[model samples]
Target: MLDPSVAAVRRAVRVALSRVAEGGTALVALSGGADSLALAAATAFEARKRGIRVASVTVDHGLQTGSAAVAARAADQARALGIDDAEVVRVEVTGAGGPEAAARDARYAALRAAAAARGAAAVLLGHTLDDQAETVLLGLARGAGGTSLAGMPPSRDDGGVAWARPLLGVRRAVTHAACAAQGLEPWHDPHNAEDRFSRVRVRERVLPVLEAELGPGIAEALARTAEQLREDAEAFAEMIDETIEDIVEPAEAGIAVSVAALAANPVALRHRVIRYVVDSEFGVALTRAQTLEVARLVTDWSGQGPIDLPGCTAARRGALIVFTARA
Candidate 1:
């Protein structure tokens, strides 16, 4: 008896595969979690039905005590799902940041390398609606503006490979149900239960309160908001590109945008233009304070001095705001 959730997940996988170019292989990133295992199973099933080859790759971050065993378990699960080409790649996570984030970065790096090596066109992840909701809440806690609030996208391109989250609309509970129906036991990562992690805190503490106060649909609402914001951001980016064609000019230090044109545009578009400038010239994102300061210089100060920013400086030069790094 096939679970309805499993059927729905298979449908989602088929839809996701349809978006990619035909006859290209897909690599599923399996992490032994219920969400990722379900994704791997669904992808394998759908790929077989569509006559597309699918490979499952698990990254062992070597952070946990028994990570290698866990990776092996994930590979076995993939093999059980008729994925004959399941492989486990080992990665060493380093840096001063949290171990969880470092592991995640290393894990993705491994996945990308595996996909490239296998000539895969896309890498499928299992981030679900619950993860999206948690991300939105974390962004709100930091008050990081619309971009942060947008959370994760269903599909994106990174390092010349398409990354697709096929289960973004599905709940975590559905994935668990699917695993149970398939008679598979997913490994539980202890880090997920630790309150030291902000996501765990949000999942266990904050989200429960929000659900009790605001109702059970809070996660759905946040995920929907994120999707809408992602679409709006994409459209805004296209507008910014068109606007840049007329206002942006190459300079010795960096790029310069006409202040008059920037001021004339709507405030929302103006912010996007500024962000584009900073990202293009400095290769860094402006903090909220830095963005506001730049806006003030462009709108209020007609001929004021330069304002120093991270990795670059913004100054008003002859009706044009020039952003360049200090020499």
Candidate 2:
């Protein structure tokens, strides 16, 4: 009999595999961690049943000693689990935005290249429900808006490559159980235990404390919140697309929105539109305070001068609020 944990992960992989074209390839981003090891094994089993080819790529960030060997072992495990095509790609992690962010950027770039070279329909990630919970908590701590709090999407397309997270709805513990049941040895990254990383701290300390104080299901609740917020964000995105086309027009150096049209919508929608305009046009995100200041142009027209935003300026010119690039 198949272990319940293994069955659960297989079910998820089956659903994610449905997105791939018939007999198409799917690449698994394996890290040798319990979550990713379980994901690779499940994807291998499910892909075989569906006549789909499965490949695995283990990225070595070269951040720690023996990282290459760890990656090679992960790839070997993938092969042992019925994934004949397993490869290890070593990436140099360099960039701004801290070590964690830089490593992530490099890893993703490698994955994108690997996926394109493999002609895989989708690249599977192993981010579990606990990871989503941590992401939501981090967003909340940063006071980010709904977009940030929405957490990671289950699936998204980037540069013609589809990225899928089959385990986002599954618990991390289940992955461990599944790996144990399958007699698979997973490499626990030492970085995951270091308190210097915010995510590690959140996983080791914050979540446990929250569970103790607020009951047993805080992680599940946080994941649920992220899911709900993502739904809301999708709905809002549709509404914005519909409303923006009618009220927005090209301006001298940027874009302009009809003051009357913006004023007619509810305050929530109004703020969203204001933020959306600046973000879509100027490629800069607006803070809540900045958004409200722009909204004041319509609500409180007191002959104020142009307000400078991150990459643009907003001012009420006649009957429209013009957002122009800063000279």
Candidate 3:
């Protein structure tokens, strides 16, 4: 009999695998961690059942000693678990946005390259519910808007490959249980236990404390919040797309929005309109403070000078709020 945790993970992977074309490989990003190992196991089973090939890629960030060994072992485990095509790609992590963000960017690039080389139809990630909850908490802590708090999407298309996170509904503990149920030994990264990383602290300390004080299921609540926010963001996107076409006009090295149209809309839509205009024309996102300042050009109607934002500046020119490129 399959363990319940394993079965749950398998079910999720089956849905993800359904997106892959028949005769094409579905590449699993295996790190030998419990989440990824369980993912690889499930992909192997489910892909085979659907007459699809399963492959695995283990990324070595080269951060710690014996990292290559870890990567090699992960690939070996992939082969042992009925994944005949297993490979390891080593990446140099540039500490650009600190270490975590840089490593993730490099890892994903490496995985995309590997998947393309392997002719895989899509790449599978193992980010689970706990990860989503932590992401939302971090976004909220940073005072990010709805889209940031929306957390990770279940699937996204990058360049050409479709990236899917099938385990977004699965809990971290369940991945561990799934690996154990399948007699798979998982590698525990020491970085995960380190207190220095914000995510590690959230996982080890913040979330546990929250759960204890607020009762259990706080993680689930956070994940749900992210899902709901994502839905709201999607709707806002549709509205913005429909609305931007009418109220915006091309200006001198910039874009202009009708101040009358913006001020007449509801506050929520007004704010979104300002943001969407700046984002579309300038290729930059406005902070809430900046957005509010931009809105003042419409609502307050004071004769103010140009308000500088990231990569652009906003100014009130009669009935138009013009956003122009920063000199």
Candidate 4:
């Protein structure tokens, strides 16, 4: 019988690559780790059957002492797996949102750029179910609300290139087992063992505790919650789009929404509409407090003066609530 881990990962790669334009190249963002290496191996094995070209790109975030060397070794593994055009790209990580967030942003941007340069239809990521659960948990810790809890999509389009996480349905242990079954040695990142990063702490301490106390399957449950939230969020997004068109209009420097229209809707929709308009117009994300204060102009009108926000100002101009860019 075929190994269950191998079968599971291969099926995931096949299904993920199926969405990409056939007869085109698919790039795997290999990090020399089990998750990405297993993904690369599966893609290499499946691409030929699908008539799709496969390659791998190892990103050197230049954080660790020997990151470049690790990336080179990963590229070598990709080449050994029948991918001839394996390449390593190095990036400088800034501490903009701390080390982890900065590194992720740089790595994904580099992957998308590589895809566009090569005309690759899709870039496959190595995020597993554990990653999704951790992400949802982090969002919850930050009080990031429902949208943040929705977690990562299976696939998304950014900068005209498609990005996919074929392994989100797969477990971290499964990827490691798949690599072992293939006689492949996977590089373990030392950061994963450290408690400095919140993610590492979650993986090591929090999740283990949750699994022990909750009797396992907590990660799967979190992943399932994220999936359901994503579906519901998509529906809410469509409703917001449909409602925004009729009630919102361009204002002096930003946008305006009908106060009467906003007040007429449920409180849930009203806050969403307010935040959506500001985000789209001025690129500012309003906190729940900020959004609620803005909503007050509609629900509790009493000749209140203009309210200051992150990148814009909200004021009641008769029947309309105007959001103007702050000078």
Candidate 5:
């Protein structure tokens, strides 16, 4: 009999791989952790049945001691799982936004490069339902609004590379169980226990407390909330695309939106249009307050001076709200 945990993971991987072309390659991001290791093994099994080539990439951020050795062991595990081509890519983690953010940026860049080099149809990630719950909870705590609360999408395309997360519906414990069932030893990263990282705090402290006090299904409930919000976001995105074409036009430096058009929609759609326009034009996100201030130009037309944004400025000029790049 197939282990139920293994079956659950394999089923998820099989469904995610359906979009990949037969005989094309898929790359799994293997960190040697239970979640990623289980994903790698399942991908190897499922992709073989579908005539899809499978490989694994273990990113070494070199943050912890002996990180290279850990990456090498992960690669070896990938090979043992019948993944023929396993590569370890060492990345220089440097940038703003602290160590965790920097490491993540470097790791993603390496994964994208690996996928591009191999012309892989998809890159598989191991973020599970628990991760989704943690993300939503963090977003809520930060008051980051709907976009952050929407959590991670199951699939997205970045620079022509398809990134897929199949286990977003599976629990984290299931991955650990799957690894044990298959005699796979997952490397437990020490960073996971350290509460210095916000995610670690959420995982180690916040979630357990919520589960104990709020009952046993807090994580599942949060995951479901994320799924629903993501659905609404998709619908709004389509609406923004349609509405933006009719109301937005080129300005002197950035872009201009129709004031009357902005005023015509409900507050929800209006705020979305305001945010979508600025983001699409200037490549910067606006806060809810910033967005409201922008919307006020249409709602409370008081001939106010230009509102300064991160990379641009917004002001009303007759029928149009003009957004211009800051010099």
Candidate 6:
């Protein structure tokens, strides 16, 4: 018999699975952590009961010395949980960034590829409330806009694969409890305890201080803040879309936004509108300063001049400000 907590997780997974399109398979990304292991176990149990098949994939990011062994262990656990098709994917991390970030990028890329191979309708991840809270805090520290402060979404589209986080509402402790109840021994990643990682620093040092000074429910509060910010960001994006429809015009070079129309909207909406225009035309996200500079070109510039942005270029063309990639 499944314990009450395990039953609750199963219920959550069932609800998440039910929301997937009909006749589509679900792929669970098993990392062997307590949260992801519990997610796989609950998802497998619920999927079998519903007569739906579930596939598991573990990404072996060759970073730590024991990563391959950990990935193998995760695959073994998935098979033990009755997952028929368990596969371990090997991916190499490259580029100039933090090792954790590079590994995450490679891992997600591998998962998307595996999902495509498995014909999965969506990829399920195990991002718990604590992870969400930590993300919110990290974004806050960066002092970015509301969108940055908004943590991971419960469901989002990535490379044509719907990514869903069924465990977002669950606490990490609850997942650990579920693992214990199921007699599963989850592997603990040493990197999580290393203070060198920014996320771990926030999770261990900063969050504890906040909880001590503010209250015990600080994490929950931050998670709630992220949820609220996400809603607000969505609505703001919708407004930006509407503004774009009203103000955007096509030019010989690229898309143009009417300076007069842009100036009519409030500053916040105007900044977002510029970002929307740049991203839609060039497939790039602009920094706050870049967006502001583009807005200035539209509102304050007197003549035509080029403004360079990452993977894009914005210029004031007569009464319209155009954004496009440099040739």
User: Which candidate has the highest TM-score of all?
Assistant: 5
TM-score of each: 0.96, 0.97, 0.95, 0.97, 0.99, 0.94
Per residue, candidate 4 scores C-alpha lDDT tens digits across 1-327 of 778999999999989888777699999999999999999999999998888988788989998998889999999999999999898999888868787889989987888788888899889999999999999999999998788998999998877667899999999999999999999999999988989888899988999999999898999999999999998888888999888999988887888999889989988878888889999999999999999899989988798999999999999999999999999
Query: Can you tell me which runs of candidate 4 are displaced by over 4 Å?
Result: none
User: Which pairs in model 2 have colliding backbones?
Assistant: none
lDDT of every predicted structure (CA atoms): 0.89, 0.94, 0.92, 0.91, 0.94, 0.87
Runs of candidate 6 with Cα error greater than 4 angstroms are 21-23, 302-305
For model 4, state the Cα shift of residue 166 in Å. 0.6
lDDT of 1 by residue, 1-327 (tens): 778989978888998888656577899999999999989989998888777789999998887899999999999989999999999999889966688778888988888889989888889999999999999999999987888899998898887788999999999999999999888899998989999889999999999999999888999999999989988988998888777889999876888889899999999889888988898778989887888888987778856788898888888888788888877
| Tens digit per residue, CA lDDT, model 5, 94-151 | 9998998999999999999999999999999999999999999899998997878999
Candidate 6, residues 1-327: lDDT per residue as tens digits?
A: 768779878877988888666556889999999999999999888887666778999998888898999999999999999997889999989866777778888988898888988778888999999999999988888877899888999999877778999988888989999999999999999989999889999999999999999889999999899999999999998888666677887876678889898889889888888887777788888889888888888678877478998777888877778777677
Cα lDDT tens digits, model 2, 1-327, are: 999999999999999999887789999999999999999999998888888989999999998999989999999899899999999999998999898899999999998888899898999999999999999999999999998999999999987677999999999999999999999999999989999988899999999999999999998899899999999999988999998999999999999999999999989889999999998999999999999999999999999999999999999999999999998
Question: What is the Å distance of residue 176 in model 5 from its true position?
Answer: 0.3
Name the candidate, 3 or 5, with the larger lDDT value: 5
Worst 10 residues of 3 by lDDT: 274-283
Candidate number with the higher lDDT (2 or 3): 2
Ranking by lDDT: 5, 2, 3, 4, 1, 6
What TM-score does structure 6 among the candidates reach?
0.94
- How much lDDT does candidate 5 score? 0.94
TM-score of 5: 0.99
Candidate 3, residues 271-315: lDDT per residue as tens digits?
A: 988888777777888899999999998998769899999999889
